[model samples]
Target: MAKIAFILLCHKDPDAVIKQAQSLTAVGDYMAIHFDARAPKAAYDRIRKALADNPNVAFAKRRVKCGWGEWSLVQATLNAVETAVEAFPRASHFYMLSGDCMAIKSAEYAHAFLDQRDVDYIESFDYFHSDWIKTGWKEERLIYRHWFNERTQKKRFYAMFNLQKRLGMTREIPGDLEVMIGSQWWCLRRRTVEWILEFCRTRPDVLRFFRTTWIPDETFFQTLVRHLVPEHEIESRALTFLMFTDYGMPVVFYNDHYDLLLAQDFLFARKISPEARELKRRLGVLYASEGARFQISNEGQSLFRFLTGKGRIGRRFAPRFWEAESSLGRERELLIVLCKKWHVAKRLTARIRALTNIPCIEYLFNEAGCDLPDLGGIQSSMSKRHRHRRALMRMLFEYYDTERLVICLDPQNLDLLEDFCRDRSVSRLLEIECQFTDAYLGGHAMRVGLAGERTPKETLNRLLPTIRNDIVHESDRIRDAQFDNHLRIREIDPPDVNARALAAFLSLPEDIARELANTDHLFAD
Candidate 1:
């Protein structure tokens, strides 16, 4: 049997924190918690009281003022890990977890699983070579000193970087240090944890160097572990299922993810939102069983069927939808405009609206027709930007009563959109390539009714092929007659006829007009 010490970093939702602690402690494992110093005293007190009776649980003596992408996050982890080690020196494994993380497997299963592997389960990748961050951003993250918390001073820093680039000023990582960046969550051997703590104590310079690094929590441990442990001894997969949005925000898990969670081999899932009560309950029930193998729920079975091509959409459409966009505020208007000016975008949007009435499109239609959104009010503060978008997404999700959404985009938007999706955290949206069947038709237009998820392969492949084929084929034909033929089978207005009077649709401000026009028509006909 493996004795594990869980080091948890909790910042919010005291109830969820208490439950997670209890769940772990119930397994007879030791846990040490570090509540964010910035969190309210009442929240911390509540959590402390909840775990006060558990002898297996301990609290960090010194709490850190945790902030996103700040050294404080790394410090918090260090504090908790140190506390756990002190409380349970005989523990064989130390798992670093977030407040929202929940174990999907029983303690016995986790221990048995770990017993089979001598390697440390830690996520690490070379900063320069990894696609985890944007292609060229590894340099900016590792080279330049990130002085301020990204949530607050990101825009100003970006502007400063741009100015530095113009002035030919550059920074480089120290030659002796190899930069490694990856997910912060990990399960490491006690020896590895001890080595990291020792390194922090003896080599204060490592901590100092990382203090100025962006999201140091991600890179600090990874860089240190890479130096301390042999390459083969470290496992790249953390065994924590964290789904990131297209915008790089961690997707909030909900009841709908219940089936998906059952299917994953991951032992834990992180950053669960407050809304996931049923998911929490289901997970609790799942862990009640001693065996690792559990029956999948009917909903899970249905979802798996849908994902594997037993449903309307085929397997060619990836279950992971990547919404690639360059800017924050372009999507809604872009989709609406495309629907009006282009035939394919319009038909797709119409069909989606008719079938699901997804709130995002409906909200956009209502707002776009009335008045343009005040994009100027969106501040440069990274926190404010995300809060604004999240609010909008929340409203869309709440009003629609569905998590599934279509990210209307074009080929040009792919890379940026992908970056944006990961940045924003759009985990629940269905993954499918968006494309038009025909060329852009001006105001004199036809509403070509496109086939839903059931169109023939020859035609559907021509219009919206799998993302793999879309990238390779690179055909420039603005219209696929085969796809148009399928659409024609459904009642489509004649090419010369225009059903929608889009003359009153809102126009873009001068600054962003060029961006809209420059968008590639490559994805569609």
Candidate 2:
């Protein structure tokens, strides 16, 4: 029987780590946890005390202060491996994991599967020949010494690297090593583990070279395995389900990703969000007994790619309904109501809410946060900013939820309006030419809120000519039957949108809008 030893490198979330260990421990695998040295002593103690009764569980002999993209992580891994090797003498293989990682399949199934394979499972490719690195510090990482955390201590880290570059203090790949880089996670046999340890002992020069390299945890063991281990004895893939963004940050899985993950046949998945209780439950051994039996769908792959994909702009945005001028839900179907007055915005948003029974936002881009029905669908700190709005839009659509937004594109919202009109392929734009109250023209009403660079009146002054010309031209196109399905605009101007007139103007199917308009006040939430 092949027993597995797990090297767990944990820095945070002792509670989650406890739960994960309990699941794996239930299947009789031995585990060695290396809590980060810099982590709070209380957290480490908590994890240790919680798992104290498990004989198979042991803490590493040494805990090091680990940094992202630093050699300390590999050192921590070695610490955990040493402890596991000593604690579990019969262990035939070992795997690298983190506090965030959770076994997707049952540990017994994982052990059985790995027991049958003699090859080491790791993702590896020639660093010079491959484009595995999508962003930041490619060859420069190896050429220069990184003495600080690249992300947290970015300025100093880069300054030192730049200074080294200026001095021409460069080095080559150490020894006969074929430099390989890929995911940091791997499953190694005891033989391979001993090979790596022996190689480390004999190759102090190589160790020195990688210790200063950027994200050497990704290359150190990977390069060693490829250089020393036979090609056939290594499977150039990791068992862990992992993916990275353009900035090299792992995509954090949430409750909504339950189906997407269950479909992929991987032993474990990491970078799980702490809020993903539902996803954690669903991915547990109880839910995935047969070890992810579902086939990986092409749509799932596209959805994953959609996370890191570029934001569409101009004609590059291919929308089935409306141009979002956003990233998340660019092609999602949407309904946006636009008017000049607050009263108009309220009436439109309320009527739609009454019709859909979903309280839609009243003033989406208004500097002053206001919602008509204000059901609190999307509450944002910078609601007026483009990035925040785009993310909210994505959440609404991707959550299988409905959205009914009423944007009062009063002068203050010229930037948003400009982007919307520029898209041309609109999803749904409900336009109402409501005249401003005479009080505002006479400077009697309060100037309300101040937006960036200009007041509402001033913004209107800049937008009037372009909007007038475009609306007229588009209206003419509507008259000439040039109104395409994608640019779905419904323009209506009633002297007053009294309930009866508003319902008729809405033109909803089965006279639904009419009924809702009539009884809106009675049934309104």
What is candidate 1's lDDT per residue for 18-122, written digit by digit as tens? 888887877678899999999999999999888898999999999988888888888889888889888897789999888888877777778888999898998
Best by TM-score: 2
lDDT of 2 by residue, 330-427 (tens): 34444555454556456656667656654366565664565323225454445434445554555545454543333445433434544454442244
Model 1 off-target regions past 4 Å? 155-172, 294-525
68 Cα displacement, candidate 2 (Å): 1.0
RMSD of 1: 18.2
Per-model TM values vs. the true structure: 0.58, 0.59
lDDT of each: 0.60, 0.66
Error of 1 at 497 (Å): 31
